[model samples]
Target: MSVGLVIRLIVLALLVAFLVSPQTFVFVFRPLVRAGQPVIYNQGSLIDLTLNHLAIVGTAMVLATALAVGLAILVTRPFGAEFLALSRSLANIGQTFPPVAVLALAVPVLGFGTAPTLVALFLYGLLPIFENTLTGLTNLPPTVTEAARGMGMTGRQRLMRVELPLALPVILAGIRLSTVIALATATIGSTVAARTLGEVIIAGLLSRNTAFVAQGGIIVGILAVLIYDGLSAIERMLMRRTGQAGRQA
Candidate 1:
């Protein structure tokens, strides 16, 4: 494993320990709490809150990836090429609206809790993934694709075995970007009764507790950094494999 990965794991372990026994952080948080307030955030278990936050983000990302990648693939095909403009416009529409606005509009229709958050994040994440997938698919080398066809590879075979493999690194780059953005943005879900680390930050803000804000911010920041680094490593590995395949061929 990479040094960064190891370090991230260590940080994650420490974060978990802190969350499990937040009182262990008394020395740090005690000073930040108001004169009469307790050192720990007792509203909910941090572990539970973090898990719920990840669930919301993960669900949104999965939905976004499926829609974005599927649409990109469709638009890249000869039969679907005419839809390119429409696809781009649709993805742009998702991004053009702010997440908060999306949430506000969705809440009345979807009701409170995770639904609105999921909708907001799904829309927020679509543009990057779609754009990157489009770039990856459209930018493949013509010679390589022609060779696949010359070798009697069917279109589906060429797409699955040749094009997508080469384009994976680029696609993964989009996923990494989308995931990071969703991680930060998911915190906003707390406003609509979603259980998230954002609840801690919001509570802190409401009660004037700097400790709560710091703890929430630190956990979210750590999660984003770790996930980003992990995806980058995966992308690099994919790129290296593609390079090796090209050399051997």
Candidate 2:
């Protein structure tokens, strides 16, 4: 009945379909291909590819979040305010360059594997997080900061006990956006010899097998949706807790 319940159900369904009965996808994808063509992507296990894809996205997000949030915190401080413009420009550069181009340039040095894909995803996932974190930190109500100061809170104490808790929801929203972007973008990594669902899509493209492409695209789509929903549920929970705390205080 509730939105949270609906999201949990959707996430459960997706996980069951992908993990418990992957063969179910064969029937779904079969209609997209000719009768004689194989309906499943047989070159690599879909589960393995999915895991690898998650690994890539997860690792990149960790790096991106750390740097983006760290930079955002710095820029919001008086001493670091001057670096704000430069940080924005740096974060923008990542989104400006296409993942393919980043791969093209990185492959020469990283040489065709998960490393370059990680680099591309890391760069591609930075801007949204940085921008959102900056907005969250900078836009806090002046009254809240004054209250914290009045309570004899130091800058670090205010940030740790007051600001960060308040900013978490907005910061998480940014992470959610960046993560969804990375899920789709990570598929491009397969072009550089990285293990991803893009391998299935690319194979299908090469062989003209629509089913393979559909299977890969559908799985990625479902994953993105499920992950987005999961993150949203967490965000809503955090917001509710934050509100409850505010009311009690």
Candidate 3:
């Protein structure tokens, strides 16, 4: 079969698995509810879960980008590159720690609620965005930068005009990855008593309700797909704009 056809078949199979049984049965878990009220996964509950999740993830994205990009820029300088090894070590360590363990540890300092969740997401998101930002800037033609400076462009002007536009796609890829992962991890926040779709999954497990688990898990999957795809679309648009700008200049 053609590659596109194979992909289409795979997607169809996945859709069927999700909609039907066996997959939802969760061999490791049993059904939670029976008849009447099975922790109903309605529009309202999902909205409540999703909205709070979006807030936490969005906040993390902003914070991660700011810190990652800023630090990447700072560390790219000769003085800063001296500390690159240390910077990379710290980022690697941050990602290596288990998120639940981190959350449990942070609870004492950050207290409960969305704050801890946001902190967790922000830290988790840092490495990808930071690494990609550093990579893109470093990969830029050194001669291009020298030429811009030779043309009397200020540091700010060179960065805004040359570095940022060129580096945007790689940075966006990192951000998109961060966003989807944050969406998945945000579900764990519900376990910590944060308001999130994970509440449904947790409650289902607590009460032995498969329906609740399926509903929550399914919604989260859907949300992740939409958000990732949306970010990718934005990245494509940005890339196109970059190309057009380069052509124009």
Leading candidate by TM-score:
1
- All models: lDDT? 0.91, 0.89, 0.77
Question: How are the candidates ranked when ordered by lDDT, highest leading?
Answer: 1, 2, 3
Q: Between 2 and 3, whose lDDT is larger? A: 2
Query: What TM-score would candidate 3 get against the native?
Result: 0.80
Answer with 2 or 3, whichever has the higher TM-score: 2
lDDT of 1 by residue, 190-228 (tens): 999989899999989999989989999999999999899
Off by over 4 Å in 3: 1-33, 37-39, 42-44, 244-249
TM-scores, in order shown?
0.95, 0.92, 0.80
- Backbone Cα, N, C clashes tallied per candidate: 0, 0, 4
Worst 10 residues of 1 by lDDT: 240-249
lDDT of 2 at 123: 93
Tens digits of per-residue lDDT, candidate 3, 1-249, equal 777556656654654464344345344233455766444554244555667777888998999889888888878876688878777766666498777877898899988888878888888998999899998888887778899999999877988899988888888889999889988998889777789878878877887777778777876786687667667868778878767346434
Model 1 stretches with alpha carbons more than 4 Å out: 1-3, 244-249
Q: Assess the local accuracy of residue 58 in candidate 1 as a C-alpha lDDT between 0 and 100.
A: 95
Candidate 1 backbone collisions, by pair: none
